[model samples]
Target: MRSGAPIPDFGEAQLRAVLDAIPARVALIDRGGRCRYANRELAEFVGLTPETALGRTVTEMLGEAAGVLLAGQGGRALDGETVRWAGWLPFHNRAERRYVQRILLPHRGADGTVDGYFIFSRDLTELVESERRLLETGAQLRGSEALSSAIVASALDAVVVMDEAGLVMEWNPAAERTFGYARHSAIGRPVAELIVPPMMRRRHVDGMRRYMETGIGTVIGHRVEVEATRADGSIFPCELAITEARLPGRRLFTAHLRDLTEQRAAAAEIEGQRTRLHHVEKLSAMGSLLAGVAHELNNPLAILLAQATLLRDQATTPELRRRAERIHAAAERSGRIVKSFLAIARQEAPRRTLVRLAAVVDAAVELTAYGARSAGIAVDVTHDPDLPPVQGDGDLLGQVVANLLVNAQQALQDRPEPRRISVWTRRAGEGAVVVVADNGGGVPADLKSRIFEPYFTTKPAGAGTGIGLAICRSIVGAHGGRVELEDVPDGGARFLVWLPCEAAVEPAEAATPDRADESLAVLVVDDEPDVAESLAEILEIQGHRVTVRESGQAALAAARRTRFDIVFADLRMPGMDGIALRRTLMAEQPQVGARTVLVTGDTVLGASTARARRDGALVLEKPFTPSDVRTALEQALMKRDPPAS
Candidate 1:
């Protein structure tokens, strides 16, 4: 009961009292499994006094089942082995069940021989139940942590956790992918040094310090866009969201970030498309305005030319004749101006014809000359007589040429006083090339590749529509040609337009006999009285019976009353326009519709005219000479009634 202790010279009675007061049941057994000694707790648990229990064996004192288990453990101790065991078993003579733990130790004699064993047993039901509950709580906590880890691992945005010292504590899989850093490398590293750009590192560290000290954070609980550096030392845009969590004696920062490189590119693409659409709408509006202006100017020009021609033919004196001829020349120049407007406004499929490239250049120069002069830019022109003609749409080709010239002029607008543009045409292999070069700051090397892209421009904001070169390229491409930026050593931009050429076929001679035969009834319809009267006079002088109507309704009524041999109806007019009038005539009187020659001063109506032509109807553009008028009449008549073979 007592080891090497002589506290107050304790006697055997006092030692037994101490042993009996202890919580554990204590006993001593001999090698035969017979009790040699027992504590008060042990003796009371077996319903026996200590003296009586000392003479009994373990099986006789406890019971068959528990004594059999205890005997084996006691045997090991007796054989010089220490033993321990725990289980739920009956005690107090099998009255109740309780969990108990026991330790058995070998008792040695003075000769070092194991002759007995010592047993120390304790009832541990309360402690065991408490431990079982604690284990369940621990398992639940581990399951919760596993669920959180799974969530972080599967997230699309990067999830990063940093301690109060700004060192990384956790880096999820998304974080590894986003920052190009492995989890092993990122943990325990300073977060700022790992992902923050060099220029922003100091600010990031300062912000963390301020937040930790004052509990006030600028970016915490907010999402923001910032530049982040990758592991390879490259910077890119990133969207970041931070949340502050206060744990026991420490603060943690959780950051969610997403790379924005692709998103930003998509946004930029959308913005560019929006800009191109806006410019297209503006060009369409400009086309509409030009059409209106052409319509207005063609009426007066037609009247002037008609009157001048009659005056010149009837003049008796040379002075009067010269004046009339001069008037006619002025009207012709005005007619060219109107034609330029039509060329720009007309947007339709190409109409192929044998076109002289030099003539296209001349028309473009004429249209851009005044603007070039006002901008203090000099334009020089050159042409090679050997330049072969190309087959293409003249109006579209002229538009392409004009766009290049205007681009050159605008390019040289901010240049020095000697700003100059050189334009020339030459015959290349099976093609003709027109070169437009400007002596100004050239296009940047980086932009040359994308120069022809819609809405891609080198001009400052609001200075250029960015579609000119794109349109030019499209037109040239449609014509089986190509436009390219020719590198010039002189440090200015040069654009070359090369068009495919076909073998030239000489036009057969046309004999015009000064005679008018087979006179027919003709109707001229126009919104402008002058235009209608002038057209009527032209038809009358050509020996045709002419009728004039200032409105389409009047023209339609007159056509219904009398079967006119031919009808010339203006495309745009009040009430019913030429297109509607023609439709009615075609339904009511197919002959008159077939003999119709639709007239339009608005070349913007080119698309409509093109449709009319496809339906086997003839069309005449306004501001025409007597020759053009006669040609239109002949074509209409020829279409209405073919000559016998």
Candidate 2:
């Protein structure tokens, strides 16, 4: 194992070249761990030449730190075991670190006893740093994936991922809550079947197919408001946005679904408020016009009746007297029609009571049957004698019934001589059902759906207001009922009103007796001259002495001058509103304020604002009738003086 340590590969010169070309440090060590030889690069790296490095200890060549690290392995190799190890090593000349990967194999003698060892070592700092960076990159990627998964799972909007086939692949917790489907149930399930309504299922499938084929979906990448069915088979509005993903290996689509049910409901409520406000404005104007006409007509009718009575009393012949009576009768009938028009046009708050359904239908028929017969249409009426009463406003219900009858009459106007209208009542699942059928030209098939929608009508613009059926729907809905229209079996339109049956509860007589019939001094205040005068007239008829004032200030001044038994004040007035008037009265004359009744054309005054409910003052909506006024006065009087209680 001297300088002539025979090299194995091709020849001594070639072996030296191979050893020099090699990147690792090569050395020959004996049992003493001395370098019998060293590669040129290793010699040069350690600032030693081959001639200077021959037959030297590795500890003297490399330095103390590297020497200590390799000494044990060198000993192990000389003991006939191969040694391999890796570790950090410090530069011999500079304050820096390097990693070394080393291997030691024993060289054998002719008798197979260990002679010395050949050692190999390479710097692994760059490779190790590369691997470290790779590991750090992997950890960062995993962390990013985890954060993304957490975000997707915790997203408020339902995150649903589907494959090319539209089967749900990822169903997050939000998706589960939104669609009422658990992940286990939803995974691998068709999203269409799970959440699409049956009617839209075909469209959904076709859209997906189209997208798959053309690489475009009409709804893809677009946010759309659509109705989605839930697990419970209930439908609601949702905003859905779908995005395509070109991830590795497979194509997928992700859908973000946000439940817009509450938002839509709120929007619908706003629309409803606007519609109601419009209706109120329209009705208020109509009511005023009708009221004025009715007032003017009533004065003439009263004069005609008075004159007719006088003429009848002084007539010399029976024919003349009968002619006078006929004129009187015609005038009264026209006045009644005017009154009915006024009643229907006014937006009176419903007075729910155990209304006799049979009586209402009978009265509606009586009012409209003659007109139908005159129009050459036969009328038929059927009723279930045992049909129970329903809880609703009698006048409003009557109006609803009348509207049906009138509509039926109008439908029959253009029909042949054999046209007939059928009205019937029956029981339906703990409910009372009233059906008005007309054998005239039935409603057009396309118009059936829109008939109940507000402002939708088939009649000429001048003939139809377009809100009759809408009003019917509103009124029936208010009474816990539904109005359904169906085509009659024999070719006609049948309108059915289904109202929940309620047993008539005989109203208990109020413990407070009627003090309204008794004489009482009352104040009537309204900015409208007609309203004040009409109210005073109605009060005078009820045996109450009334004083009329056109302003809240005047009313208040009048109240202070005289302690009125009951004060009726219009809510909206020029000088002061009824609310202000009441506050002042409460502070100045609390007794009179207690007896005050507020009349308002604004329906919201008593309900919408905190002030209204807080005030809690007795309120009567305007366009009120004589009875509404009398009833309000009676209630005020009764409150002022309870009988024997």
User: Top TM-score: which candidate number?
Assistant: 1
Question: lDDT (0-100) at residue 47 of candidate 1?
Answer: 92
List the global CA lDDT of all models.
0.79, 0.74
Tell me the spans in candidate 1 whose CA falls farther than 4 Å from its real position.
Answer: 1-157, 165-167, 171-237, 243-251, 311-327, 504-522, 540-545, 551-567, 572-594, 605-608, 637-645
Q: What is the TM-score of each candidate against the true structure?
A: 0.65, 0.42
Task: Give the root-mean-square deviation of each candidate in angstroms.
Answer: 32.9, 32.0
Across 477-508, the per-residue lDDT of candidate 1 in tens digits comes to 99999999988898789999999987969588
Over the stretch 73-104, how does candidate 2's per-residue lDDT look in tens digits? 87788789988776788867647888776778
The list of candidate 2 runs beyond 4 A from truth reads: 1-353, 359-386, 392-403, 426-429, 441-491, 512-517, 527-543, 599-630, 640-645
Using alpha carbons, what is the TM-score of model 1? 0.65
